[model samples]
Target: MEKDAGMVLHTLFEQTARRVPTLPALQWKADSLTYEELDRVADAVSGWLSRKGVGRGSFVGVLQERGLEMVVAILGSLKAGAAYLPLLPSWPTEQRLEILDEAGCCCLILQSAFRCESASFTGAKLELDDCRALARVEPPPAERAEVLPMDLAYLIYTSGSTGKPKGVMMHHGGTAANISRNAHLSCEEGTRCSFSNSYTFDVHVADIFKPLSVGGVVIVTRDIFRIPPVDTLSTLPSRVTRARVPRALKRIIFTGEPPTQASIVRIPSTTRVLNIFGATEFFDATLKIIDVHGCPSKLQSIGKPLGDYVPLWVMDPDSKELLQSGAVGELVVGGLQVSRGYIKRPELTSYKFFQAPWLASEKQEGGRVYRTGDLVRLCQDEEYEYLGRVEQQLKLNGHRIDCATVENKLTSIEGVSEAVVVLRDGDLERGQLVLVAYVSPSSAAVSVSSFRDGLPAHMVPTRVVGIDTWPRTSSGK
Candidate 1:
């Protein structure tokens, strides 16, 4: 293989294969596949896809839940020289079909047991158990084909909070580098990871793919995410000693809803809870590991960058100039691990990814940076303290409102909004936190005091406002 080709997925597979061939590569209930077994299965799946004309540059969808089948199908697609698109089982069947239609999937590798007749697709349908049977029937391959670093490895879709979900195109080199770096830091034998997030969330990229790629054990629990916060806290840690969470970056089991007594007792003494801070743009940046020893800092800071591939800068929000180390400004990311752009959304891509003005050298390759709509303060200790989202900081009755803080408060509010609220800053500090009109003012006649009664005092809004109309920009964001 060429030198550049050595940085992709198959290369990592070879390393894990050498280190622990008999080690458990994946485990779900009674089914467990070793590294050697997984490799052979990938080979057969690749051969099958190759026969079906799903090769390099082809798009394939893996629609399944968190199980041994999901792992095999993903590896099979990669081995077949096609990009894998993860179809989240938690999503409505129609939503999954929409993504399948948009991406133009050549084939959908799904589990026969979970297959719904309504899922629309023009591609060939392959079942997981049948594929496993095929894996046992086919002969082993001589060697896996090499893939380029810039080749598309997977197209991860964003949560469909805005109108419809969109896919983000990620290259193999960047994805491999991210997984490799995370594996070297987080995984080991008997280290069970609570693989909780849906595949669509980028959290899965690091949570599920990174650990398994390194031969670590992952517990794929199918529990619905909305089981009471206390119930989740109590039950989640029992399955895995360590878990990855999107919020609560600085502290674990504290922020969303305070863990109940039952929840606290469920935690293993050695369990390590990692509150990860990242976006789809950068896979995993800063992470704070909290365990029986207790967390070391306040509850909001996102820690620091992980591995050599990440570079962070705090800059003036308005000027786009790099701020002094201790100054508060916008957080900018420039790194090899960053995603290329949103698939088929050039106008949206241009809005987020931009030329780095702080970098004096114009010739620096990969110098283009992403302007994360976050406001942060650089501490003297060289850590980024997340102030709030720049997009959510709005003026409400002359007071600066951090939408994140409000949202956190609303998470505890009972029967107020449909539990879905978006804070729009008309201008800095002048914004409204709009509810989806599930609760009417005339019918409920709710007061600020009642809302504050449901949450911690700081989260209560200064003005309980209503809006009948909202103007949109050209992009409808």
Candidate 2:
């Protein structure tokens, strides 16, 4: 616990770089960077950003594809004492502008390809070419900002109950705690980790930060074969079960969604399968190391809490009463991993996060707890069996889709009066999940093209069906 105190992400990377300056820090296709080189480049970015009046209490928007440049932008943002906000390239231009404006981004680090997309942005823009040129030049000596553990480390946007995206503010202390715990669990000096997740996803933090914190190598490439065999891989369950996994992969982590029995059985016996349960609001809260040959029932559980750093509780949704073992209730997470709540959303933050005096003795984030909105029952063994969500939220592929948000968008369509969104197994043989939208007024016409232009790819319903009338309960919903 003492070691976990006051730990920051960039400071940890600096420590590791000093210990292993010549070690490979990042590798993408034919290019690579040693720890010393990456540190210098990140410093250059920090200096450049400083010259542009970007520093502490600033938000740096990172809009670039996954590669060496992306990693540099992230580390450079941290080095500049600013939180990096990742904007997906696939998002609609309007959606990108909305987030950039909402976060009050002070600067944007982007590639030439996204210049037109971000032309409407009001913040100062630093292109990838600028970062490369800065790396080659000698950076001037500048005073580093005094960054604290509670300072914002990054901001990840997720679907909100309304038709907007909410930013989850993660601090350096919590991020470092999760990274240290994960690295201790699987990483060692010189271990190679595969970086496959999109930078927009929260899981990318574990994919990149976990390894770099422990003097390990991060293989940043879409093709696994392009780089040397990695020791560990973190990705969605669908990808690993459907595609051929690398034989040399020793450990595999599945998150975003639960892993099926068939998927777990597909992995080689030599590789360890760890199913992680968490959300964008928090890092990993619970983890289960799957025994591929064990009883299938074991795989149904989301395992125990991640040691004492994260505490899990079950409480009645209506009564707000704590439930004992074997009772089903909403899962509550409290610890250093709990984020600082949504950006500029006071009402939503107050509704989702609340104080818990009982947790004070545990020294958890001033006794703050986040309601996960997930229902689960505590097993006799202290593990948890995941029940369905308290709401209509769905996790398709690896992205979380809020049904209300999609429905809100649907209602905005000219002809749509009422709408409902759900997940269906469009291809049972391949175990693929598809989003379906059901709208009222059978005569109403809905076009998938319109949805494509208005919504993100994952949020677009694959099938839109018009119903004459909706079935109602006895009391009417």
Candidate 3:
């Protein structure tokens, strides 16, 4: 839409604000803000951040719960030409501090309600209340930086194999391309989309900006299950249930994990279920609109690439050679949706984000493509059937958990020499999967509760078992 080749995300929001200044932009509980109101407040935030020396190339840490304030902080950071890094309050204090330090954040926008000791951060700190107060007073005119499309827009930290979270550096151009494609394909004017995902999750970018970019409203709430009917709803497949499905829901997006045939049949035929397959490295790359009446085989496919902006290919995991149709191989994603690579991780970035020699003659964006570790097979009609990952990563409750990260944390515990983590069926009767950690030396007294402090709830193992010996195949001497 509108030649998004070099567009910036916030610029689209500003354009929509000017078009429909009185339209509702965001609503949370009893609080709400019109386009004009939200735009003006975001300008004030940008002014405040600008005064604090936060401009292009700067990183702003956002520490707030999901609500109106979080959206303001995000918009304000973008308007100030600085990338916003989401610092979840639920994370351990040390984890949050580590992320902020890694990103070299120049400013932190923290909500007064969220308590954490940020004395370690040698940067400007502005409370959300102060941001609100600034909106009440006329902000001084400050020269706005010329934020370019290639400028960094945000930093999202995903679980890493090195026992630390890695920040994904996303730029304005790629993010804008993703939001524009999704909005043009699914959203409409004045569409009301539910903001259900956490800000730390990359999908939240689509949930919030997708609607705002199209003069639509973002229904910001702590619980989407309790919200009124909205034009679009995005959530995990496990969260979908007959009782929780909103009435009059038009479209529901399922991602994070594959949806079962049983889960698809529960939705009303009138509603469209879009099973999106994507990663933090890139946004929504492929989308499959489930046909409730179709066969079970069709439901298993993660439909074709979203548009020309994101091109998909299947390649040999070892040789990195492109594979033909019907051959199962790693999924390679190329085009504008590809992120700017991981922050401060050039080795990993170069390995994962590389230019395909075959595509050198083609018109590819930046001549870069991301090697998604995910394995897949190209099916008929240009659809793809997911065949799991080549690495030991698991998706639980809509969040990707690196098994190596969990194992690393387990080994860090006292008395534990080595650790291995695996996803197993915890409840066979309910067909539920759970993470279980196995440590060497059966005598190692490791408590599962200890992991709760360091890892996210989803990444923590449900049980820890000590094993005296490692299991191996019969061929192993």
Listed in order, each prediction's TM-score against the native is: 0.75, 0.80, 0.80
Query: Runs in model 2 with CA error above 4 Å?
Result: 130-132, 138-141, 160-163, 223-228, 357-364, 392-477
- Sort by lDDT, top down from the best: 2, 3, 1
lDDT of 1 at 117: 53
Give stretches of model 1 more than 4 Å off: 1-6, 113-120, 139-143, 224-269, 291-297, 360-365, 405-477
How many angstroms is residue 310 displaced in model 2 relative to the true structure, after the best TM-score fit?
1.2
Clash counts per candidate, in order, are 5, 0, 0
Error of 1 at 372 (Å): 2.3
Whole-model lDDT per candidate: 0.61, 0.81, 0.80
After best superposition, candidate 3 residue 83: deviation in angstroms?
0.5
Q: Quick one: RMSD of model 3?
A: 11.0
1 versus 2: better TM-score goes to: 2
Tens digits of per-residue lDDT for model 2 on 1-477? 346858888988998999999999998877889999899988888888888898888999998887898999999999899999998887888998899899999899999999987898988888874445778874832978678888999999877446568899999988787788777666678988888777777888888888899999998966433446789888776455446777678899888766655456568889988888988898888989889888755665899988787888999877767888999889999878889999999999987898864565655455889998887899989899875567776889899776755765665566565678999889999999999999766677887776677667999999999886666311112
Would you list the clashing residue pairs of candidate 1?
234-263, 394-429, 394-430, 395-429, 395-430
User: How displaced is residue 317 in candidate 3, in Å?
Assistant: 0.3
Model 3, CA-based lDDT:
0.80
Return model 2's CA RMSD, one decimal. 11.0
| Candidate 3 vs. true structure, TM-score | 0.80
The sequence of per-residue lDDT tens digits that candidate 3 reaches over residues 34-69 is 999898888888888988888899999999887888
